[model samples]
Target: MNEVLDDPVSQTMIDIHCHVLPETDDGSVSLEESVEMCRMAAADGIKTIVATPHLFDGVHPPPSRDDIRRKIDLVMEASGGVVEIVPGGETRYSHEIFQEARDKHTRIRLNGSSYMLLEFDFMMVPPNIEMTIFQILQAGLTPVIAHPERNARIQLKPEILVGLIERGAYAQIDAGSLLGSFGKECETSVKQILRAGLAHFLASDGHHQDRRRPLLSKAVSIAAEIGGERYAKALVEDNPLALIQDRGIPFQPEPDLAALRGRAKKKAAKSWYAFWR
Candidate 1:
């Protein structure tokens, strides 16, 4: 079990992306598991957790707003309110998203805010991703890209994510990735993203209480090493809290695209040299 950090910042942590709702998707398997997950989150100092189940992923049918709310209520009650669980979904990129975005009462939006957690395929970024993000923005919702560092395409070319951030989409790095839970490639990409100021939020895209646990202290410490304590706190605390409140992110910084590009070029050159040598 990961011990909660002693820092004051961890006490008010807000996890904007977590899958803890019972039988909602591939998250907590049952109501008991949901309660346990909430306990785990609270122990780790997560005061609030947005229960983001998978949505419009072509696998599970879209859960109705009432169903999500009911599940949230159940978990909150069962856990004795150990942690505040808000309603949200990790919506996959699809044509159906535009329609949901247009709806005033769309359940997919995070905590009924204009922010939405947008997910893409793991293997590739869609070719029409820019246009899709534009449409979502036009619908008055900010798309927070979930775990771009885990994407194969972004791992190979992080500047692609820079373009999306430039296009007004925010990037969220998974806590697990920072701790090398996803592997070295993901860890490298996440560090590069943070160093270049490309990430706006850090969250536990936590699915299980044990495997991908809902803990952020360890990862936040790692982020503090890479980008200072203030910048790291903004990712897990200030920024995400602002997001759930439907306010502008207080810590967004312009990504250093020039620096990122230069690094990419150097890495390519090094790879070429190693190949020849």
Candidate 2:
């Protein structure tokens, strides 16, 4: 039986990232395309999908929360009995936007979830990234890092990611990367991160039908084969569900090498022998 069997069919699936907002960023270009994306998601049994359109500094300007809400209503009306579309924005991370987030703008969070899905640039990472994340925590919102494997900086130096997790930030890998959909570098690094137990979330991040359609299940199978099915469920469902709750989601601290320093000594000292005795 699948580890997913733990949850009933209705609760088995939730997509944390999708771009069903019409003519927004590089995602669905029209209402028709948005409906198609919804249909695709519904066809695959995805009950909930958070529409994560892009927001950045100098790049594509993202729509505001109100705009996202209106569009969500539009999607719901145009769903054609497809999938349920919720509101989330792939928010940009920079010290510049940090003030704006607190003062001017707020985006849609995961449906009834405290976690806000966010992403960084493909090229350079934000300089004061850690401090900004601390600020986010201080403000009482959890930041779910989107597509860490696609970031060139993190791919080059994976430990940079370890530092982020240690600071209480969670990482979400793109489903397409598991299928080598991004490229060789992203695919290789994503697999490595999964083995390292660095990935806590998985998302479709689908942009279109012909190329970037939703593939959460396929990615789940890939993760199951590589990292065990249980880990896959946690990455896709358990961790995400924890984030969705009203209070802050408490997670085990990031995997730390220092804590594993005395591994062999403890392994030999294990109390499993008591059970056998």
Q: Which one wins on lDDT?
A: 1
Q: Which ten residues in a row have the lowest lDDT in candidate 1?
A: 1-10
In angstroms, the error of model 2 at 132 is 1.7
What lDDT is obtained when candidate 1 is compared to the true structure? Answer: 0.90
lDDT scores for all predictions?
0.90, 0.74
Pick out the ten consecutive residues of candidate 2 with the lowest summed lDDT. 1-10
TM-score of candidate 1 to 2 decimals? 0.94
What lDDT would candidate 2 get against the real structure?
Answer: 0.74
Judged by TM-score, which candidate is best? 1
Clashes of each: 0, 0
Task: Report the C-alpha displacement of residue 102, candidate 1, in angstroms.
Answer: 1.4
> Which digits, one per residue and each the tens of the lDDT, describe model 2 over residues 1-277?
1132324234366688888788878888898888777777666657678788887645668687788889888877877545667777777776544554564235635664557776788886778888877888786667888899999988766777788778878888899999998899889778878877788888899888778897588899999897788888877677665655544544343464443234324544554665577
| TM-score of each predicted structure versus truth | 0.94, 0.82
